[model samples]
Target chain A: MTIDLFQKTGAFAENKDVARDIRVRDIIPALERHEEVILDFAGVGAATQSFVHALISDLFRQYGNGVLDRVAFRSCSEAVKQIIRIVVDYMQEGMGIDTEDAPEA
Target chain B: MKIHLPNSAFLGNLDSFLRGFDSTHPDHLEITANDQWIAVHPVVLSMIAALGLTVKPGNVRCGPLQARSGHYVVRMGLLKILNIPSSITMVEHEPAGRFIPLTQIRTSSELTSFITEMIPLLHVESEQAKTIGYIVSELVRNVIEHADAEHGAFLCAQYYKKSHSIRIGIADTGVGIKATINKSHEAATDLEAIRLALWPGVTGMTRRDGGTAQNAGAGLFFIKSIASVNRDFFVIYSGSGFYKLLKPSPTRRLRLNADPFGDRHSKRDDLPFWHGTAAGVDITLDQTKEFAVLLEAIGTTYRTALRERKNARYRPPRFL
Candidate 1:
């Protein structure tokens, strides 16, 4: 599988599908390479909570435990981080992951 | 147009209100959840259902609706149905310290236009007006689901010119903050209850047979977090009277680290929960434009909730 990650800077992604595509097309292939996957969203602008949820939820589900732990997010704004935090919590609770075992923002 | 939840003890009152077969149409019928009272106008309910995906000829189908007095939760399951927004608006008003209420049903269609229209009333750019739209959307969405008002819903947007702060109050007469907390745990005083309701996961409704944990709790928690730490203050009234829970004092406002979500310290004090179902929220914003963003986010969230509820009802759980 080929790996290609595109970083876009804007206030918000138009919808969740665009967000999910970015992950499925770009991030997943990169994960196929090594046992670990680290995604760096360092310079992207404001992203919605739902968009982030669509992108990462499947990964979290597939990985079972520590799925997101292998994928890292760096240098996101407080707003972006908050969205990630909410989505992660939703996924964690939905998947029945132990809150203690879940990674923090 | 007004509906009252006469008997807080019975669910039949609410069922009647939802059906729109109100023998007492045009008059207010009070609806109560966990003792919280919300007076929903028949027209408003009709409009909301008509505008959303739950447009069944004579019945109402909402996503997940859990009501206790202070904390009420309704997930909008129709989001996926509504087309993406072509426009948005945000508003900051301090016209008076009193309540100023606006409805999402009216503004959902012309969000961009509404933002532009508010420009003259607010004398701000369309962008800032859009932010007000977001804030209002989130606040109102919270109100519709959580704020229990039997009659008139109170809303206010106060602009403190001196400090460059805008505080918006969305209140209802149903149940106060304290009563919401009592549903989860017993509390001696209103203050303790108000504070406990502010905590995460303190919902009056527990999990139902087909509902998800998303239905467990967390609406007010997000609303308060967005308003209190990020914006300004989030105040509530319940079994007791009105009270304000602000993070940094006015004197030390800027010196305080901007934490949209309150610090753990605020939870240190054991606040009591009030009995009854109604509750309200006050949110502040530094920039008006963020309001529109918030509003769209809220719309999408509720729409999803509505869909989820409809799905659950149709696909009942089947045990082996």
Candidate 2:
């Protein structure tokens, strides 16, 4: 399943509450259905760390290392990609996993 | 007691003035603006108005007077917003073109709308405006997520065309830095809490505390890094600790140091305890720094930090 962030929210998505709502209302259900969730960021212009964190961090804690294979990001700009990388690596380090060896989603 | 508005009511002067007010005093204080060169930012005015809202009616008096230019118009707008009576004679003049009026951010949607409206006021290119929006969004989000402010966050921006700079300020009356971070790290002092808050992956929220899962505590670290790389000035005041990133020299390359809170680079001021946090940023709008470059630089630095922390024999958990 593809989730168009810009369509769901807007070009700029930076609110934790919105991110949490997306997680509860959209992402989690897709994951439960054994479906691959692609976070499409084609039209999104920018995103803050807070927003990115709110969307993905809890998912990692719930699914553990298995989430690495279930989720992927598409059409991310350089800035958005960098933010995602920071969030992923930071979460992985917190979980005592080596980011160097972790699979890219 | 009469309080005079400064010619340049930026963060420093405004903070000092606001801190000077004695809440314990029973008498209402009078605010006077008689200078011929009275100039103030909406952020300052908004803060004063917010402070006034906390006090009883008529406890704060704003007596206005003569000004050389449109200063009185700005003052009048401030009074109108605050609902304070202005005794100064009414003046008919156009408002300043460079100022973005005070805005309140109570939710993420308001933040997004506020940033969209502020881009034009910044007088920058589309891409640069987006970058500024992202930075401002992060600063304001800190208040929303952690401030616990009863009245929400306040934001205002000013463009200085000649100086090629834009100044933005966000203030909140909520739990200060020390109180927030000390929830997880009980031993942290006020300055230490500020330093920890700036460090990569040092988040105050945890799963047990009902914090969002995606919060990796990277907001302030990324902000400070971007400010350093772009040669902008970033100042954060929470509780009694004040942190600032002094502008680097033109020839100096961007480097993330071991002590991100070093006295030489980021001065930590120990002021009287403030009830909440106020952050201000001054960025050169004309600078050709790209957001992509800043993201890459900050990403590299953060990854390096993460690798080191991961390799440590006994690394503490990141969220705590």
**Which candidate number maximizes DockQ?**
2
**Listed models, DockQ each:** 0.14, 0.58
How do the residues B204-253 of candidate 1 rate in per-residue lDDT, one tens digit apiece? 54323212222234444455544433444444444443334455544554
Q: Best-fitting candidate, measured by lDDT?
A: 2
User: What are the per-residue Cα lDDT tens digits for candidate 2 across A1-105?
Assistant: 998898765777776777888888899999999999999999887788788888998888899857968989999987788788878777766677766665655
TM-score of chain A of each: 0.75, 0.91
Q: Give per-model CA RMSD.
A: 15.2, 4.3
CAPRI-wise, candidate 2 is: medium
Candidate models: Cα lDDT each? 0.40, 0.70
Error of 2 at B3 (Å): 6.1
Clashing residue pairs in candidate 2 (N, C-alpha, C atoms within 3 angstroms): A53-B214, A57-B213, A57-B214, A58-B213
- Tens-digit lDDT string for candidate 1 (A5-84): 23432343324445567667766776776555555555444454434655776676566547665677766655566566
Against the true structure, what is model 1's DockQ? 0.14
